[model samples]
Target: MTHTTHTTRTTGHVAAPRPDVYRALLDPAAIPRWRVPAGMSCRVHTFEPHEGGAFRVSLTYDDPASTSGKSTARTDTYHGRFTRLVPDGEVVEEMEFETEDPAFQGLMTITTTLTDAPGGGTDVSVLHTGLPEAVAPADNETGMRMALDNLARLLEHPG
Candidate 1:
């Protein structure tokens, strides 16, 4: 079957405990730091880390010329609800782009799961599904990878 929408999964291991990793993912202040893509900045307008809670965020590209199918210009805004949250285990959010563009018509769910690594640390897997037709799966994977890398760094070496 031919797929029309994008879906991506990225995995990584962080040299930190699951509780620590979970806190960073759900923390309002830390969310903007690690969730942003490598060349972009994330602004959190509102965040409440609990099931049925809502959050709003905007990501702006560093290069104003850069354009994604979801955003013709610079910034892409989103508002989503926390569908599920499990302490030190998992988080699921149902999100929708805040735009009238056809590409941003559907709701997307992002799930992040955490588990203990074989030797130590924590294993994190992120799955993003229901991406619109305009978004590319490869790009999403790359961005997720970057975010995971940042999470590793942030957890292993706190400033």
Candidate 2:
């Protein structure tokens, strides 16, 4: 019965306005497109992008054998509620895994801030807190970086 609190932060620069970046974060279509790390795909089961709203997301690994080690399936499902939201400013949410594993128990919070950069670009950064000890810090950093990179790519070059 061990408990730990960890935090991981990653930032990206996009040639877009804060509103656009904020929209993409809460948009169902855009979330799955950029929120996942390499070799992983995201599926938004349900999303209500507002304060006090809830969301359900599934992250599936490309490889059948790939798993979070705490979840039984290759696809880990998480459900949480939006704790707070400030348009063109910040988004905050809290989530917990749906696994029976002890290591994956407890809640985690993710806060993303969108601000105006010096050149009209948007500075987006996400801070994930309360990460369980089951997940390594290095892995979390790499995964978060990948997700941010994807977000930047999509926001910088949108159709």
lDDT of each: 0.89, 0.86
Report model 1's TM-score to 2 decimal places: 0.93
lDDT leader: 1
**Candidate 1, pairs of clashing residues:** none
Give the per-residue lDDT digits (tens) of candidate 1, residues 81-143. 999999999999999887777766688999999999999999999999898887778888898
Per-residue lDDT over 8-85 for candidate 2, one digit per residue giving the tens place of the 0 to 100 score: 887878888888888988998998889898998888999999899999998888888775535556877889999999
TM-scores for every candidate against the unseen true structure? 0.93, 0.93
Q: What is the lDDT of candidate 2?
A: 0.86
